[model samples]
Target: MASPLDRGGLPGHRVSVSPLDTAAAARHVATTEDGQRLSLAEQVAQVPTDPGCYLWKDASGEVIYVGKAKNLRARMKQYVQLTDDREKIPLMMQLVASFDYIVVDNEHEALVLERNLIGQYHPYFNVDYKDDKSYPYIAVTHGDVFPAIKYTREKHKPKTRYYGPYTDARAARETIDTIRKVTPICSATCAEWKRVRRLLDKRPDDAGIIGLICAQKGRPCFDYHVGRGPGVCAGMISPEEYAVNVRRVERFLSGHRSELTRELKEDMSEAAAELDFERAGRIKRRLDVVDGLDDRQQVVFPTSVDIDLIGFYREETIAGACVFAVREGRTVRTCEFIVDKGLDVAEDELVAGFVKRYYDETADIPAEVDVAVDLEDADVIGQWLSAKRGRKCTVHRPQRGEKRHLLETCERNARHALMRYMMRTGYADDRTNQALLQLESALALDGPPMRIECFDISTLHGRFTVASMVVFTDGRPDKSQYRRFKIRTELDEANDFASMSEVLGRRYAPERMADERFGSRPDLLVVDGGKPQLTAAMRQLEQLGLDIPVCGLAKADEEVFVPWDDTPVVLPSGSASLYLMKQVRDESHRFAITFHRELRDRAMTVSVLDEVEGVGPTRKRAIMRHFGSMKRLRAATVDEIAAVKGIPAAVAQAVYDTLRA
Candidate 1:
């Protein structure tokens, strides 16, 4: 094995530990000593004058950066010369890692790979980084039973109407909002409105129903009010109409671009014939927008069965694979994930592995499987799945036809889609999205909160009290950042406020928050409650001198609160901001309740066993395991319980008596 000192003679070798500059790192790789298999001059002698991607790695076989080169030889030589300033090349060179290159046939391929790799490894110093702002998509929940149109940075649902994957989310949102003003679909579900109308027309203690009726009927909603008049939504769209619109959206999202295009065109013509120029203009513009989108689709075909098509490419540690599921040849699910590949697996295998891992437990699966490359054991997987579901399962790798071309086009799309998602989520290059960027802006903080701590408390009958703290970095959930605390300080009493304070104190007591990897002072703190709870949190932070700006989410009113602020900031109840807070609060609640239930169940389950002197936890576990669940155990005959590995008949009889009593 090569000693660490083997890198001592490399240029900029000692400067890597300091603050790293991305541009400087790229520059350093360009000028550093040739740690290649051949000398710089020798490698340059054979350099191919082709467009391709160049890779730079440190001595330890880690990808530090990936770049595209229009001229492989020239780009390679620039690094060989070592003439750049130390400031530019300093940190990257300090690692003095070896490097490699792949010569693609064209600059486009190189560009594609460069984006793919950067997104995959997210090297510390790769410039031209992609951010979420660079990709956006239009979301039409209108695909669901009660559809709401919106814009999304990332889609969580498949087969939803998603437009663009646009380079600008704000623009997309503005456009969609404008369109919504023209068409105000009722936000209330059929069930909700029906219940409300029934209760208002008759019943009253159903104040919740009455409140909803008043809210919807007192004035035109924001969407309707935005348009010319209350006439926009004088009557809620009937279920039939809603279903028709949903089917149209489904068709559009299923990759039936022409269907969406046709609808837009028809709407435009109808508006024109009705002498509604403004409405006509809206429809016309939408037509143009849909047309523009349709033209951008890499594959356009009409078919029946839904299928997920996938493809892949890789350079060293960085690999890129794209998966696009097509329903009747229209793309329903287009996604890409960046991963590392040390094994020499085929691109097809990589795609398959990703599909399995990603959709392992997914509730939705396409009807057909499509691919660009065939797997060796497709039958094994297909058979296993078929037997499991009692359905015919076939995996097809199309060759030499429209299907093949479609698959290939989908593969290309998958590549770009993966790259775009990586960039948007800041996942390419294995980096966290600045979750705190929004938090900082919302709170006006000096810097991004590298560590964000949110606390939630859960209790049942003032027993089994528990609190959980969930961490978010860069706007995404980080499970590793999660921490849980059992309410131990006050055993017999459940004081949520005190429990919260104790958990927060335990988490930040220097001994916990002082670890560099695990320890960073939160720029922002959130508590899962309204004003009073927030006040309690503030006092705790103040007492600790943590002095972090704290806020609380009120579940009842769906408001965000800062202490001393009289009026709570009310975010749109369904806005992404609200959604995020809901997720955080829900996660914290889930974690706390999960821990609480474990304690409660453990005590509850074992107490019944412990009442029997001869029975212990081991024998109890054996009985429960054999019986499957508590219900089964309760219903099991004493003889059946006794048959469990270690439970004696007397112990089983005692347990039976204890449970019955």
Candidate 2:
């Protein structure tokens, strides 16, 4: 809420107007307090003609929208003159009580600052590119002495390598399993190595320690006995030898098949020359596996080719974007994104926004990027990318060639992805339209509720309480707008009414109303309970001075409760309106339960370890990493628990006693 002059180092100005007077003010005329009429052109003429970012705020001083422009004055003039023909502009202007701008040095600076401000404020009117599902990745813990290759959806760990954010999660998991089968790193072996390595680092010439460790021949895992793993646990494979296998797995996942195959063949030859027939046979098997994988990959270009292709397909306000990551002439990975374009932006602007956001998160930046649409600021974006990659990067729009054909293929894939999403959500169906109309008549509202938000509360024995807000637009669920809340109020028992009131109060608060993630105000509000919940919701809205329509749907009989009527309105069992209501309610319940369960699981994991006198987060993590899971930890003996790195014998005994108790 700081004044424009107080924000950053940029010189700017603020314009204020009354919300009630916005209709007349939309004509580009404003009446000052002294009764002087100032035309919008005159007002815009005073703004600096520099590239910058602008912010529009509602009456409560919350930022509702943020945008960047090459010329600040021209952009302001377009808004004032009502020449910006975006569908949402008129509605957004009506809510605009004031506006401000921050001038930047260049177009690229404007773009960067605009993105940062939008992320910080989450302005509602900005285009939000959100993925409904988290794609899976194959992660390798390269920081460890004996790296563990695993399938993961999250990439939070530092000093680790992640590859293939595959759209097909099952395929990613299968790949990880196959790699583990080819190059197995035993967990027991890793634990022992960590322990010995720590001791050796502190005492270099401890012969007694080395001799004692070397004297014990540890039992090998099942994979080692089955010939699928190197016998690291059985002392047959040294740490240096185990690291070679880890490097091979990393190379395989990184799409370096040619180099890895050559190296493996050389290793096999050396093993054969040394008369190690068993080792040579193992290397030969690995080489065949690598060759088989290489043959399966589809090659679209020469071996030296490395580039990324981006294509998009937009229908109405929703767009699906496809990214093809080509490495060493083959398609190594593919990524898909669903974008909600709140405004009717130009195709080139859409492409620019998508490129910036995508590359910002991705670690691998190709030297060349080909897009379906031609961008005006391609050079600026390329410069930004080059700085990020520490090398020269180029952005291009392929006209006619094999690259164009591949780009077209990527666009086709994007279209198919959009179609799949449409089919799954039943978006814009005739039945959905009929349902909206029916609901409007049944609820006695002004018009069909195009945007509906439903709330549900979930808790288990008064623990890990949570709430979910699910949004439905045009009778189709909009997962991007969905939000979860962890209830902060302390409660001795389950209280749905109080929980509903608290969630509604928090959601409708002035600050939350302007957040981009919350989206626009819902046409109607639905609560998952009976009359009491409906009353609670209505009361909260009334306290906040909000006039959104409120209703409650009871699960017992599917009865809908409205404030004016004492009797519950129950639509026909097979009616479309009833079905839509049930869908929204069920989705809210599912979302809330999922969030609650995640909290409960995480708390259980931490709480069990927290009860031990000497165990903290570090030692707890060590215990979990050593044993893999709580089930195995519980089954482990005291001596086994004490063997984990960083876990002292006294602390391990305390942890064992706590779990046993």
Per-candidate Cα RMSD to the true structure, in Å, reads 30.6, 27.1
lDDT for model 2, on a 0 to 1 scale? 0.77
Clashes of each: 21, 1
lDDT of each: 0.59, 0.77
Tell me the tens digit of each residue's lDDT in model 2 across 329-408: 88877777777651245677678877876675445677889997788888878887887667888999999987899999
Off by over 4 Å in 2: 1-91, 97-123, 130-132, 142-147, 155-158, 181-251, 430-661
Candidate 1 per-residue lDDT, tens place, 46-99, comes to 556777666667777677766557787787666656553323244455564555
Can you give the TM-score per candidate against the true fold? 0.38, 0.52
Tell me the lDDT of model 2 at 528: 95
Candidate 1: global Cα-lDDT? Answer: 0.59
Indicate the residue-level lDDT of 586 in model 1: 78
Task: Return the top candidate by lDDT.
Answer: 2
